[model samples]
Target: MFIKIIKRTMTIILIIIGLLVISYLLFTNFYPNFGGDIANEQKEVYQKSKQYKDGKFHNTKPVPKDLSFPETLKLAYTFFTTNVPNGRPKEDLKTKKVDSINIANYQGEARMFWFGHSSFLLQMDSKTILLDPMLGKVAAPHPLLGANRFNKEFPLAIEKLPAIDAVIFSHDHYDHLDYGTILKIKDKTKHFYVPLGLGTHLKKWGVHPDKITELDWWQNTVLDGLNLICTPAQHFSGRKFNTSQSTLWCSWVIKSKTENIYFSGDSGYATHFKEIGEQYGPFDLALMECGQYNQMWSDIHMMPEETAQAGLDVKAKKIMPIHWAGFKLALHAWTDPINRVQAKAQELNITLITPKLGEEIIVKDTTNNYPKWWEKY
Candidate 1:
């Protein structure tokens, strides 16, 4: 009996070692399998851009917030240990027929289609843009990890996608950007707009030098009639270690000839929202981050009330909450964020638009007569 037990222990240890070796090999080999030397150079340039004339790359007074380490760990434990199942209503979760977006209809104007979980297709005049497009089954690289994606099917697959003028990425976090989705739509995309050094990840995935454009905070890029401005957000970035904050993370301001829209990419409560509003707000619509929130990372992700206040700070005419209802990124009930945001918006006299997955919401004239869509979940 002792000999058999010893043999079993050795076998188990050998199996564990083999798995680790295989995991490392796969990650090193194919993880960043797209970009090459040019991509690395771009990353260096992005790093250099962060420094201000005063010599410090980060010059602004750091925004103060509560991000206690112990609180964060407790939040993580609650999310993992708790078996609470959070998701949209089963009936509402089903994908309705969504036709392809028409750029001609939105010519010289701004329009957006939410594809669930921080992904949106924005059209400004003739320019077609996709923001943090994640058309994958899982947010994490390995299917076994990360939460399942909210919308299982996209209105249009990457291969079937229309000619995309540009793809704007918020950060390198898995939920915000998926490698598999990028691989599929890489060829369809004409240009890539990302914060700081994120191009490294894209180039590693196969994007070319001329196609990638990395920007720093407050930097602006002109695409057709639309101006894509990279604004500051309270968040960090990295797909692996030795790379955290190597790339800048930011929200975006999409301004066209007639309208301006703020995409609050992903951020927690910060006075910067008010600053952003004063600088480039009074927007027609604000797509603020409003999901996957907890006390641990409250400094990085805003709670529902904070999200509603962000809209007011930005002086936005209407608010549509994103970053929730698609994945269980936090411990809150699946419908908690939306439900909270909805009540808060009503109390503040702010118009809230609750769209279905793949629903098209016209910012200029959002029709709110639709039934309480989230209640069905």
Candidate 2:
């Protein structure tokens, strides 16, 4: 009887394991096209890149990509079990709805609209540009794996957006390169600018090949009246477990005849910031990353203090802290990034702009002030 009982337990265990394997396969492979196919031509182009080697891309500076299996397990365990008090707000955060008509009619003035987190609408030189527009409810492959966005509604839906002159991507991470959001807005966008190997993802998602332009680090392109240069960032990328570092990540430099702007995609404190400043210093404005960071992954994401310093390193006349106030991708309090960066910016005498989500920030206007909207929550 004991032998029979052991046999039954083993059978059930095997059945459960089989079911789990099947579920994972369906989740990753069958749900939808995760991204564009890496075609032979694309692979040949990647092989020519200095950063590509051994079937993957590498950062210019040495950076660790993965933690040990045990450490990853511990992270997952803590993430689910910990009581992250300020990880999310009790009530929905406040936001403004941008007037689409005003945006369409504007001419020659450089302006920006923050749509929470890293996504922004940058109108410069009479052209409308979008940066990492993950305007979706969730920032994961599926809603099951990630929390919904902090705000219940986006300031402007894709249907309501004016014809975008260009859409720029920093990397292939879901938060920065969402699949659903791309599908919805591809028809309305005229062109897409992405780091090396990321155009494949866009191509897979139905963006016309002619409309996509891929650039390596330090490569510049002239679109309309703006000069865009792809710059370096210390980060890794992959949508699935097996494809890590297959795509390059980068920051961006947007220079117009009147203004120079820097967008730090996502990066740790590195000497590249200084190099970029020397090459294109005295930026009129800098959008720096300042959230979702922890000591465990310090080599990839910058701390708040580092964010302030990076702004200075790039010789930015004014700085705005991004990558926070939208999602809880870390263990720290939701308000911690902004609070700490604000203090550090004050100490460093960096001119910081903390705009509320959806608030308009005129690039040339220095006197406009934004309320500390997160304090009430």
Top candidate (lDDT): 2
Best by TM-score: 2
Model 1 lDDT tens row, 41-66: 44445445643222122324443233
Residue-wise lDDT of candidate 2 within 169-256, one digit each (tens)?
Answer: 9999988999888888899999999999898888877888899999999999999769999999999888876678889999999999
Per-model tally of clashing residue pairs: 11, 1
lDDT of 2 at 218: 92
lDDT values, one for every candidate: 0.76, 0.89
What are the models' TM-scores? 0.84, 0.95
